[model samples]
Target: MTSLFDPLALGDLTLKNRLIMAPLTRMRSQQPGNVPWELNAEYYAQRASAGLIISEATQIAPLGQGYPGTPGIHTGEQVAGWRQVTDAVHRAEGLIFLQLWHVGRISHSSFHPDEGLPVAPSAVKPSGEVLIADWTMAPYETPRALETVEIPEVIAEYAAAARRAKEAGFDGVEVHGANGYLLDQFLQDGSNRRTDAYGGSIENRARLLLEVVDAVVGVWGRERVGVRLSPYGTFNDMHDSDPVALFTHVLGKLSDRGIAYVHMIEPRATSAGGGDTVQEGVPCSSELFHPLFDGVFISAGGYDRDGALEAVASGRADAIAFGRAFIANPDLPERLQKNAPLNPYDRSTFYGGDARGYTDYPALG
Candidate 1:
């Protein structure tokens, strides 16, 4: 049986174990430039024991940002800032991947360049409120539909971001296509109501994501690129008429591309209460979609040690990504290896905070 501690070949890199630190949005980047700083470096370096540490979701361009203090890969300063983080993780003997992201309609105009409206595949308005630059909750506004000609610009941004990640000293890059973000909005039918080549059918709907993947792969090659997806996610008021069909095609295409891995969020994680709240009887996205992808399969959700062990041992998932658990336990892999009790995480400081909930968690002595 494969244990969580077992080493696994993941693309060009071999993970020392199957415990991955999921890309968590902490919104703590330095202001004015959304650049990562020394504090961010310390937070990631503290959790360097994981098999792989996927950095917080980083916007590929200024327009890609949706929340305050989130880091970006677009500017020279941002790249330099992330270099500090990558250097720290490497010095700690850890491998890390930067997750390239675009929030689309999940954003408010205040975060946009010149306060422009958020862009999406359609002009639909999402149901929830978004966190703006001032840390206030504002209702989501109807986003501007991207002109068909404008999409190539978006694809180019992803490629540019991948190159920036490389320059920043990351081992690889993961395209953020999950959790009702920009790519997710394009994938599902509820948010993407377009008549052009970018939407309408399953193939068309997945076109942008695949194109972004191709662009990123061009920069990092197939072995160093991965894509994250959330099939049954309802967060940000996202839905699909036929999720299985949509993701089956998406996963199959990604598999055919022979990329590094496909990270998926289990349906339970996007349940009504919260991402960490587990809903009973929800199907595991990895179990349903892992077989569709030929590369490394990583599953993220509300997973305990026993559940993670079973998922890997049973071959349902190749590795497991932990979010909230990793937030509260920097030495999570060591603690799990010894079955030690985990420190409870504070929800209040999960976002837009200082070192309190970010790096203040004590490791096992």
Candidate 2:
């Protein structure tokens, strides 16, 4: 039986255990250039016991900023700032990967310079609100459609960010193609209505993601790259007409590239009351992906200790990423192994705040 504590090798890197710390956006970066600081280092270092830590979604360029305080890897100063974080994690003998992100239509105009509209594959306006700098939940704005000539520049930006992540000492980079962000906006047909080569068929929709992956791999090599996908996620008002087919095709392409791993967000049924019907977009089993991709498969979203153990033991997932659990318990792998009680996470301080809920969580003594 494969236990959660067992070591696993992801590409050229070897992880100590199967419990990975998921990329969580705490919105606590330093303001001037959205740079990471020592405080962020301390927070990640405290949780270094995990097999691998995927840093929060980091923007690849100024045009990628969706929310305030999220870190960026584009500038020299930002690269230097992240060096502190990677050094701290390394000193603690932990491996880390940076998640590259671009928000696309899941953003507001205020975050853009000159109040320019956010960009997406198409000019579709998603139905929902976005969390901005001041903690205000503002209505979504219709994003400007990207011109075909400009697509290569965005792809190059991701490649540049991967180089910076390597310069800052990260073991690998995970492309943020999930969570209704820029890549997801293009992958799903609901938001992408472009008639050009970048849209229409599933292959066309997946083109940008594959291009970004190839670009990043060019910098870090295929073994040091990963990609995340949310097949049935409804967050940020995202829905794919055919998730299983779309993801199976996408995963097939990723397997051909021989990248490191694929992290997937599982489905959680939602309802207003006890008798209300569950939301229609339930996801297929993670086991279905095992044969499709020839690399590590990680499943996230509302996993408990026992459930995670079962998933890995049954060969459904190579690893399990704990989001909220890791937030409260810095030593989550230890806590899970001992079956120790966990510290409850404060809901209010989840997004933007000082060190109150950020680094103040006490690990088991």
Candidate 3:
């Protein structure tokens, strides 16, 4: 039987342990474009002790951006900034994966090109809110529906971004197809209404996300790729009547991809924003998300050591991911192994800030 600190092989990437650093958006990048900076290098390096670290969600294109201070992989400067971060982690023997993200309509027009409305699968408006900048909470901009001709462009953009992530020094990339983003919007009928080949049927709606995975796999090969999904999450005004049916069909498509792993956030778990919302017009529980994917599964949300052990022992997941714990405990793997007390994360400085709630967290002595 494998233990929490057991050596694990995630395709071409071999890890010293199975405790993964769940992708958390701290929004520490530069403004106007979310370009990375020296401070980001320091933040990631401090947490380099993890077996694997999935860096924060990075926008694949300008219109894909949602919140301020999040990183982007579209430009030369951003790539250069991330190179330093990757180099720092590598020097400490840490393997990192960059998450490719498209926030869809979970954005404000203020952050877009010419301050225009953000785009989504359809023109439908979603309930709920998002934090923009310091002291700014706005209603998600009413999104404009994408034309059929524009679908392939977004797919290609994700491919280009995956190439950029490789060029930027990441060992691999994770496609962000969850948490009510563009991909999830397409997967769920509540936020999508298209008569084209890209909507209506499960296979049609799953087209965009699978295309994204295929394109990234083409660039990075299946072994160096991964995908993140929140089947039970009701985030960003997202919902699906039959999530199990949707993912079961989708996961069947990924069965032969030879990808590294599938990282899942349980639906009813307390998300970064708070509790799970799988009600009417809300996304359902993610606790039963394990059977969707065929490869290695990494489960996350509200897990401690005992819980993680149980999941692995029960054959539910290959690994466990922690968000807040990683923020407050950079040496999380070490702390877990030693049975040491862990620090708490400060919620105030989670997005857009200096080093206070970032690198200042101490390790166990």
The best-first sequence of candidates by lDDT reads 1, 2, 3
Kindly state the number of residue pairs that clash in model 3: 2
The digit string of per-residue lDDT tens for model 1 on 238-324 reads: 999999999999999999999999999888888522555688797678878988899999998889999999999999999999999
Cα lDDT of candidate 3 equals: 0.83
Question: Counting only residues 3 or more apart in sequence or on different chains, how many pairs clash (N, Cα, C under 3 Å) in candidate 2?
Answer: 0
lDDT of 3 at 180: 89
Q: Each model's RMSD to truth, in Å?
A: 1.1, 2.8, 2.6
Highest TM-score model number: 1
Clashes of 1: 0
Q: Which stretches of candidate 3 lie over 4 Å from their true place?
A: 133-135, 273-289
Clashes of each: 0, 0, 2
Clashing pairs in 1: none
List model 2 lDDT by residue over 72-170, tens digit each.
Answer: 999999999999999999999999999999988876777766748899999999887777757688888888999999999999999999999999999
Q: Indicate the worst ten consecutive residues by lDDT in candidate 1.
A: 271-280
State candidate 2's TM-score. Answer: 0.95
Cα misplacement distance, residue 54 of candidate 2 (Å):
0.1
What is the Cα-based lDDT of residue 225 in candidate 2?
95
Worst 10 residues of 3 by lDDT: 276-285
